[model samples]
Target: MILAAGLGTRLLPLTKKIPKPLLPIIDKTLLQIAIETACKANPNIIVINASYLSGKITEFLGAHDFGVEIKVSVEPDILGTAGGIKAVEKWLSKDDFGVINSDIIATVDWDALKKIHKNSNATATLMLRDNPDPAIYGPLCLNEKGRVIRIVNTKNRDLSGAEPLLMFTGVSMLSPAIFERIPAGRAVEISSEIYSPMVKAGEPLYGYVTQAEWTDAGTMENYHKAVMARFATCKTSIGMTAKSLKYVTIRPPVHIDTGVYIRAGSTIGPNVAIHEGSVIGASVILKNCVVTPRSNVRSGAFLDGEVI
Candidate 1:
């Protein structure tokens, strides 16, 4: 299940018109990237749950065929993570399923995750990573044996012997047993509401640590981080094709989509992404920001660290 139903309150005005799932990450939307990631596991069908701006998500899904069968479950009211999955219980109850947050950019080894999940008697296997900072991003404690013993302060067992805290990557493979654990008919987060309690009960929840390329693009800073990281690694990335026009200076690591025309004397980038249909006027300067689709940056403007 691709969890796409959050209001994305952290992104605010950017998500006011475009839902978080449809937010562009260079050439593709977050949802598109997530589905492609899930396809690697070769599931029979993929399910996306959408609430805020459901029509747009629905429309976006219909525009592309990703080879694998895809279905959208529109929630009239925003169902929190666990609730959203519970809403689609019928479609997912037959087998173990993988769940990913649409706003994250992660290239988890699906085969490796599946291998460990299938080999264990775990109720759920979460993809965890070394916590960059436990103070900022809450910690998930894992034991030397790979069992997830605590989330934040919620502990399944005494944590005196636990290893260093790890971060949950918002990716997990779960048994059908999880459905029975989630309550029916309400909004609730899977972490605090379900997993924390399960951990306290000593449920067989495990962590599958990975050294994958991953980032949560749910905030502006991380969004910029994801874009910059992609620019640095992807040699044939969309940003590489942004050529400088006569008198226009385009710094490296700038992604300009199709149909965007920049006038002369414009300085774009170092860290920037201009989406489709945007017009960059003469003498405009843009850096460390994202241009939403079809935006028009007027002549003689200067913008930095602003999502326009």
Candidate 2:
């Protein structure tokens, strides 16, 4: 299941027109990237929960046949993470199901996770990484035996930096038993509600630690950082610039896409991205900025850290 019902308040203006799940990451939306990552595990059906701008997500997923059955659960009222999953309690009656966040960009060894999950016969297996800067994300503490003992603080508010905590990657495989633990019609989070209570009850909750390529592109700063990291790793793509006029000069580390027409004698990049459908005029200098799709950067414009 793809948890994608957040309002994405951090990435305003950009998300004002589109939901964060649909935000572009190079050639694809964040949701598409997540789905691709989940495809590695290859489940029979993929369920996505949608609330904000459900129409666009519905249309986009419909247009692309991922060669697998896709089920989108539209939430009339934006239920929090746990409630959102509870909303689809009927569809997930099989063994265990994997859940991935729509805004998460990562590639983990799905086979390894499944092997451990099935071998351990755990009720829920959280994909955890070594906690980095405990302030940004709270810790998911585990016992010496790798059982998740507690999850303290949160990405949103983490002033108390706890120790011996691994970071939850917003990815997990859960048993159908979790549905029974949640109270019906109440919006709750997995960490505070389910995992915490499970630990108290001494349930078979475990953590699978791995070093995977992961990032949370849920905010502007993190989005920029994730894209920059993608550039460094050669995972980013530069789209076609107008070669007819040859008015383009792209500096190092930039990801531009289709419908971008660069006028003659314009210098772009050195940390810039001209998203699809953006027009760059002559003598425009774009550095450390993003020209969003459908935007027109006038002639002789200079921008940095500003999204057009």
Among all candidates shown, the one with the greatest lDDT: 1
Q: Mind sharing the TM-score for model 1?
A: 0.89
Error of 1 at 214 (Å): 0.9
lDDT tens digits by residue: candidate 1, 56-79: 999998999999888889999987
RMSD of each: 3.2, 2.7
Worst 10 residues of 2 by lDDT: 153-162
Off by over 4 Å in 1: 154-163, 233-247, 251-253, 304-306
Cα lDDT tens digits, model 2, 200-239, are 8999899999888889899888887766566655543576
